[model samples]
Target: MPNRIEYYNFVNGGYFWHHASGETYPLGILVDQGDVLSDRQPHGKPAGTLIIYKDGNVAVKELLSIKSEKNVWFAISGCTILPKINMTAAGFTGVYSDIGRTTLRPVIGYRKKDKKIIIAVRPSSSITRAQITLKNLGCDFGITLDAGGSTALQVKGKKLHNTTRRLNNVITW
Candidate 1:
């Protein structure tokens, strides 16, 4: 069956996740009651502590509690991912949930489940449209995190890959 949530092994590549409390719903921007971030916008990751799984192990890396990049961490699950060819949406960043600011949150991170890495991020230009597309593709549900410049995928604990400026939200592959 097709589902929006996925699991992974951090071996091939890690994935990202977006969470928000019971905010932005029906419109359903936030998934379940958990931490969330706008990857498309470079504002930040989840507001709470985020655990990073590395190299297909149970070890978790806690993202430092800071206001800068040091606090930023990646999403690693019991899944593996193959190198993905980024389509677009790069060099963008944004503040958390502030529409007045000119920024972007990119979907950086992957989950390896069912032989695929599910990336998470905010919709680049049009969130509504992006959600529509994902729903059409069987996403059904998704959380809107930071997009634009903030959207970045990190692999191997401290390495970043994939960045562009085409579709700020949603995983291309």
Candidate 2:
């Protein structure tokens, strides 16, 4: 039985040796089956990292707050688009800007009633709009994935949005 889904993008920005050819390395951590494939700590606090375990458990935690565990399978790190605290409390203000700006938005959230993870790609919306949409959809907690031109969402070999720019990382279920 599969407990959760996994997605991969390029990498989070961080300390790295720049290539003369203009190729940049991923600075964040990527763990597979308890084996670390890439492990470069991010330079600053990002939104957070989504951790998925072998038992079908999922969590969105603060940057650098999580320690490696035996049952942990993998994780995705990105700038904290939305924090868990705001999701639970519903007090969204000053945490985000560009409310009027619209772009492709990718989001991950947990629906407590359904006890399932919700993955969505909003065709065009701002962070504020995304928050309102997620709240209305009954998400108890959520976080924004990479958005703007880097946004990409695919299901069953079908592309949800046509993104020309190559993404550094992605999350899938």
Candidate 3:
């Protein structure tokens, strides 16, 4: 916890620490989320995007519609705290984690509290359940993006080491 910033009481069924500039940042709770736009079978590539609004909100999303061209998929989540990464990248681009085959994979994305980074995990099959868990754990809002190895969390222009590939779409800041 050298670069410790803040703390999230409940994340991925456990508490998580955030680091920034070799020091952890102050943490906050996840506040809001919605799967209204998350399309799994997107006909288009689902980039799995995480957005932090200027108003202080963070969200994970699907870039394209696996279902059809007209229908796009995206999972939006808002939280009491969504930190922004000072540097790096975001998006699941390839097969790094045991996805589709594994049970619960890692959830890589962003936090808004001290603008630090955050990563969470959920089951492989359903992103909804993960959302529910995040909700219960102070992260009242959060959406499931394309999990598995395709999950990536970025900062600035560089991608983090724990980044995942095999994604369909990706939204940037």
Each prediction's whole-model lDDT (CA): 0.28, 0.55, 0.34
Top candidate when judged by lDDT against the true structure: 2
Report the lDDT tens digits of candidate 2 across residue range 41-122: 4443333556678887777665443454447787655434443333212222344333225887777777778778777778
Best by TM-score: 2
Candidates in descending TM-score order: 2, 3, 1
lDDT of 1 by residue, 9-126 (tens): 1211122333364222111111112233332222222222123323332111222222333223333211111121111221122432242123333222323233222344333434
TM-score for each candidate, following the candidate numbering? 0.27, 0.67, 0.30
In model 2, what lDDT does residue 22 have?
53
Q: Lowest summed lDDT over 10 consecutive residues: which window, candidate 3? A: 79-88
RMSD, one per candidate, in order: 15.6, 7.3, 14.5
